[model samples]
Target: MARKVYGISGMHCASCAAIIEKRLTAIEGVRHAEVNFATEKATVELDSRAPSLDSINDRLRPLGYLLLDETHDQGAAESETAHQATPKEREEAKELRKNRNTVRLALPSAILMVALMLYGMLFRPLPHTLYNPLAMILATIILFGPGRTFLRGVASFLRYGAATMDTLVGLGTATAYGYSAAITLFPPVRDFLGAGTHTYFDTTIIVIGFVLSGKYLESRSKTRTGETIEKLIGLQTKSALLVRDGKETLVDVSEVRRGSLLRVKPGAVIPVDGIIAAGDGTIDESAVSGEPVPVDKGPGDSVTGGTINRRGSFTFTAMQVGSKTMLSRIIAMVEEAQGSRAPIQNLADRVAAVFVPVVLVLALLDLLLWLTLGTRFMGFTEALPLALNSFIAILVIACPCALGLATPTAIIVGVGRGAENGILIRNAEALEKLAVADTVVFDKTGTVTTGRPAVTDIVALDTGTAASRILQLAASVERLSEHPLAGAIVEAAERDGTELLECSQFRSEEGLGVSALVEGREVRVRKPTAGESARPEAAALLEEGKTVAVLEREGRAIAILALADTIKENARSAVEALKRQGIQTVMITGDRAETAEHIAREAGIDTVISGVLPAGKAERIANLQQEGRTVAMVGDGINDAPALAVADAGIAMATGTDIAIAAAGVTILKGDVGKVPLAIGLSRATLRVVKRNLFWAFFYNILAIPLAGGAFYPIFGLLLHPALAGTAMAGSSLSVVASSLWLKRMKIG
Candidate 1:
């Protein structure tokens, strides 16, 4: 299957989006389609040999909408430079002007309609010559001018069998105007009905007035939702100073090639992803990592594009430019994530799919039932106009716009909030999954404890050499190895400024240790097995949660080196937070029982599973699942990939291996253990908002539909006016949007 995103035009409400989504999904070879009303974009997944763009557009043209190609707006949409007006910005500006014009037209129509309704009901009715022509002129201008889009939508619906909110509004207003115009133009029709019966001129104009004003407010609020992406793009610097052979030349950031040295001064954003080649500086990486603290960057340290250098100057060799840069990748990830539909949204889509058709059927039945029964039970003079008013009110009030706006609006705001707090929620499903996970399993090495291990204990078995000399010899042999423990030993030696002898014929034993000829003596460093004559000091170190290595020279035990990893500062606090939320925390590791327990205890984990190999990790996660626990695994290495994939929600630290990140569902940008609970909290909060929005959207329609159908007339002697019904429909959609907007102010982190 292949997936693509296309810009859609002429979506007025959620019902319009639903119509497009349904039609697109019905196409042959198309697997799924999601149309987001707020974003005004449709994401479609289809077979490789699916329909062509022309065919897709052919299906949509009759629906009064257009699909724009991905590359159509090259300069505006795809440009990395952010200072220029983007395609989205241009669209928003145009919408603002259109809204102003709509309001200007709608206000006059509304005032005229109010005066006409009051004159007919409160006092004596005006003559047809005076009131009919004035109402006719105002209603026509409102319907054809500010309300032209709905008329076009209705025309498209008639031709293409497409039904939407626009169709309902247009049909309702047109019926009122057509009936009223007939009564005005022909004096016989007015006399045939009754002397007191007045034209329904106010209903036509007032409905259009409510719709235009509602659309203006909806458009403005929708524009604010895309500000997150705009702000992120704004962080990119437009130009950089390229350094070549001691000469610097200014160039666009996009023009900087990989491996080109770029000079960055203090107070300037890093132009691209690169490694520090010279000098040192403090870089503020909050834009990408959400870490407020400034990070120190020196030679060999990586600096991401869009980060600001706070102090000192530096020269960095660009490693990733353009779209491959870290900031660009983040923006792309967020866009895709925001566009994805959650499973919860399916319910709303399914409801919206049938909502418009059902509403149309009910509206027709309402008119037929009332006209047939009301004419005999009451009288034609009193019943016909009331039946007509009832039909118009039913059609105007039943809007699928609220249903369509329910989930996507909340998801967009929730996901955008997550991004703001250094949490990269991969998709809507992951966000939903994280909310319900009951158990969280942490990989010990890089998750609970800091992955970096340091030499904690050194013991000399015999008097062959001093402690410093023993460390030097061990470091010399270990330098040839790439294991984490080996690196620790090498680092300890370097930190102490110890002189190391050269090693030759270096060889490493898998899962055991390294061997080398150091100072012309065969030296070996290996983990002690069962019954090995390890010193009491080494055993003590192991008991204290340190990994001990036995070093021997010339068949004699010479020294022992013990290295231990320290727990993260925030791990315990994060675990405690999860516990408070009624979530169980477990630590899984391949370390010795004592070592694992020590780390787990420090991290406040309730359960510890130690001595588990790489393959056993997934099995352990599966066992937890069998126990009915919704597991969330957190890891940052290749070995943890299987476990990450097996769990309900896999959270990967951004600093970990690429495989780990690929296996995980969520990635914490700064690799902070505390973000684990933060992600879950945000998910739960977002889901709550989604449920609330869905509930209100459904409830609003259910209650409003019945009332608009004149269900309350028999008991309360009340009928919903078409103008009031239109106002209620507008309010329902705006209420859902407003509730979703509340998520932006939530304190997720």
Candidate 2:
């Protein structure tokens, strides 16, 4: 079965929602139909074979409700829907619609309640003739007006041969209304002299009013708790600068096409995936990568859509546009995951299925037991009140408000906090697993180090001039090349503000370093000479195992520049923090053993697995698990995908490729390695909050239900009034929401 959700237009009120729900439910093989007037959407569950897509669309169109496009599973049909609104827009629209509906439902209900209260307070002892008629009219509107959702919910539950929180509520309110109507219409005959007058009209109105208020508050709070994705979507710009036939035009971001050349101005959001063809700039990719610092980019470098270009303008050919963009995919994944039911929700659903019938049977048994005790002490009239209270109390108290709030509240807070810190926890279970991760496997290149090569030390083999001067000449030539080592050499010279002599006739070797005519002489920077020195100072540096860029001019070695992929500034501190929390940190890389060992030692990593291929990393993770470690793999490359999937949990960098994010369970938005520890702390806190919420929900009802059902009447003769029972029920739901709100203030490490 495939689940589908679509925005349902033309639903003007709650009644219209009911009509659409009924129409959808009439379709054979439709398992569930939830039509929310506020969200203006219908979430339908159906067997794939029952109705074709065209058939479903045809049926909905005639009912004045347009079934908008179905949101396919993430990455399922990326190429087809280029102009579709992102998942974030859809979510926000749904929320807006829902809030509007809630207000519509709540405002009239509140006004009716105030009117009912005024009538009760002002005319307490009205003539019996006037009292019953006035109360009956007020009770009927409350029962069938604001209370209609409960009636529909009960009817749906009955049709499906299951029960829910709605079943209990519907039964309770219906019984109160029926009893009140019976007494009002058919005045009881007096047994001896005086007539007995008892009408439950006020009780019926009070229950419906209080319950509606609680439902409204709960709906608003849950909606607010789950707005993180909407906030993420708001980060994207609406349009892009497209260059066509030598003319620049501003186009909707969705209209930008692949192979189209886009001109990104300074401080503009890169609107499509493209390679940097010209110009130098720094991009603030924190939106995508969660890295605090902006990364420098120039000609030939690739840039993703949604990232901001911070420094200079560049023109690049778009490789991916619209839904194929990375931002769209992330938004889609988050939306689908949010709609997907968690394990706990599934359990609650199952329990609710059987819960209504059981309560109804218990209510029937209570009525029977009271009747069999004989009419000496109490007649049917007296026994009915007790029986009705039990039924109403059961429905009102048994709602899984706490159960519903438990996981979702925690997940919302956890994911929201994680995103704020640059960590994107895709699902609740990932957060739960991360809290208990014992071993963390890191990808060496991008995960630990900056992944960019840089010149560390310069050694002059034959000193005619200073080694710095040799580096200056080399930096000048290498500046024109796009190689990693070339950028490193140039960056080192630029950092020192060293004056680079002009160079002409620059030629780059594909795998080897560049050669150029510098200052009218041939200067070549390449791999080390084999026979120059077994114990050369450069050889010692190489043995310590750094990548050394050797510079030679006119066939005489001038200087050796030691280069290595330097560790990120936060990598060392993050490793230490993990260690303090008892998490073992390890590095897995395809680099040579000596270089890996050097990085591991400097970063304070406990284990080093070097020269491992992408598949080998997965095997290493499996091996670690066999040795009884709950491993978590942290990586940001396509090579890391296999290992990330194989580990107990995977933490990918937000700046990582789509394949890596798709494979990993967690993606850190902020490129800060420190978020790894923060994720763990958040998971722990969230789990704690969920458990506490569930416990209180269970404990409150376990104690309150018996008290309301007159369990304490035998001891202190104190039976809870039906009016107070409604208040307590509202209070219980309020308490659960309050507990969840406390999670918002929790401080994570």
Candidate 3:
């Protein structure tokens, strides 16, 4: 299946998103679809028979929504460069202007509503003058002007048989306004019933008036939710210093390509992902890596775009430019993750799909029941007014906007918060899974221990040669070998400033080490064969958890060199932290039992899965899952990709290979194992906030819907006024937004 993200237009609330989601899911070749109301984007999965965008839009356009390909730049919904006026800014301006214009047009209706409220409080005998031409004129301005969006919702229903939150507002206010207009325009209808000449022009004006005000406030608050994305975009540098033929020229960053040389000045942002060619500096990479410490970079080191050069200046060759840069990928990942829907959001979508229509039916049925039977208990005059009150209140309060905003708003904020902490949550499903994981499995190499091997011990046998002489011979041959252990011996020789002899005819074996003719003598550094046994000194070094390389002349062991992989400083602390959280930590390695056990004990890992090859790592994780444990895998190697994909929640270190990062759901940017626990804590906090938001949304509707429906009216002698119901409905959605915003202030680390 191929997945894609498209900008969607004409979404007003959760219901509008639900309608489009269901419609798109029904399309041929589309496997799944999720429309995020907060992000205003739809993530769709398509099969091999991929449907064209035009076909998808054709189905959606009739329902007043369209899908725009982000690449075409037509009707583009969001932009990455923050300093420019982009499509996102224009759309926001348009929405805010639309509301302000409506608020102005509804001013007279608002004033009239206040006058009616004061007069109705003082009088008992309702008159025909209450439904006069002046009131009808004001209500007409509201229904056509400020209520235009609501009318559009009604038109959508009439044209496509789709109902949304707007449908509720449109139907309720339109019913009240049409009835009141008929009573004022023609006296025959009022006299035909012989009931009363009462009109609900006041209900029509006040309900829409209050709703428009609440919508205006809600739009302002919603804009603040995208601040994190905007800040990330603002980090991009607009230009770079181009270096060519020993001359410096300032050019746009877009002009810099692969192999192009760009110079970074002190305090300037790195132009793109590149390798340092000259000079060195202290780089403040906190924005990209979430590590508080500034990193020192010299020649041959890699620098990332958007990181600031703090002290010195350097020039580098651009390896990754434009969208391929780390910062750009991060922004894109954050956006997609924010747009992706959580599994819990399905519950909201299902409810919103049927909520509007059910409320419409309930509103109509209650109105009919009140008009027919309520006249016996109270006179016709009181029954007609009470029925109108119940009708509008029921429709206005059960809008379901709160239900739609519950999950997406929190997910957006949560994903953004994770990005700020150097943790990239790929999607909402992983975020949820990580919050509940019970066991964390770590790949031993390059994860718990630094992958770089170093010389730890060296001892000479009874060969009458000094240990330093053995080191010189081994380093001389190992310098010609490409093995990592060979590099460690060479580096140790260099550090000791030992004299080296020129070697000839170097022959290196894969499983064994290398051999060379140095000064007409046969010198070899090789592993022990099946028949060969290590000396007592070598066996003691092996027991100390170090790999021993045997140095021999004439196929006999003369000296022993031992090397060990350095354990990360924070590995032990990271394990202890997980254990403190009641989580089990296991180390999986390809080393023999002795080395793996010793490393596990040193790193505080409770269990060790030793002697497993790279292919068996994923199986071990699956086995852990079969034992009823939620497994989270952490690794930083190409071999860890399969295990990362198979684990419940895969966290990849930034220092790892790209394939491993791609296979994982979460990424720690700085390659710090300590961040593993911090990421889990943040995920847990985010999930808790989602639960709280969901509860509040469900609770508000359960309590408010019945009150508006007059379930308690008969006994409590209480009825929810239409205006108050509208206010409460708006408050419900705003409260959810506020709850999501609270996540921004949490300090996860």
Each prediction's whole-model lDDT (CA): 0.85, 0.71, 0.84
Q: For every model shown, what is its TM-score relative to the native structure?
A: 0.88, 0.80, 0.86
Candidate 1 per-residue lDDT over residues 465-561, each given as its tens digit: 7889888888999999999889989999999998778889999999988899987889999987654535577667778788888888887777878
Residue-level lDDT for 319 in candidate 2: 93
Candidate 3: where is the Cα deviation over 4 Å?
Answer: 1-3, 25-32, 45-58, 72-89, 107-134, 191-199, 455-541, 548-562, 747-749
Model 2 RMSD, rounded to 1 decimal: 5.8
Q: Residue-wise lDDT of candidate 3 within 1-749, one digit each (tens)?
A: 99888877677778898899899999989999878888788889999886899988889887888886655232111212224554445566777888877877675677667777777678753455744676788889888888888888899899889998888898889988988888778889877656466677777888888788778777777777777778788788778899999999998676777999988889898878999999999999888888889989999999998889999988999998877889888988898888887887888888888888888898888888788888888867778878888898988988788888888888888889888878998999999899899999999888998888888887877569887888899999988999978999998899999988899999988887789999998899999654444567777778867888889998778888889987788999999888887899999999888888888988999999999999999999999999999999999899999999999999999899999999999999878898898888888888888889889888988888778867788899888988888889889889988988998997563
Error of 2 at 486 (Å): 4.9
Q: Enumerate residue pairs that collide in model 1.
A: none
Q: For model 2, what is the alpha-carbon lDDT of residue 400?
A: 53
Where is model 1 more than 4 Å wrong at Cα? 26-31, 46-52, 72-96, 115-129, 455-540, 548-562
Error of 1 at 616 (Å): 2.8
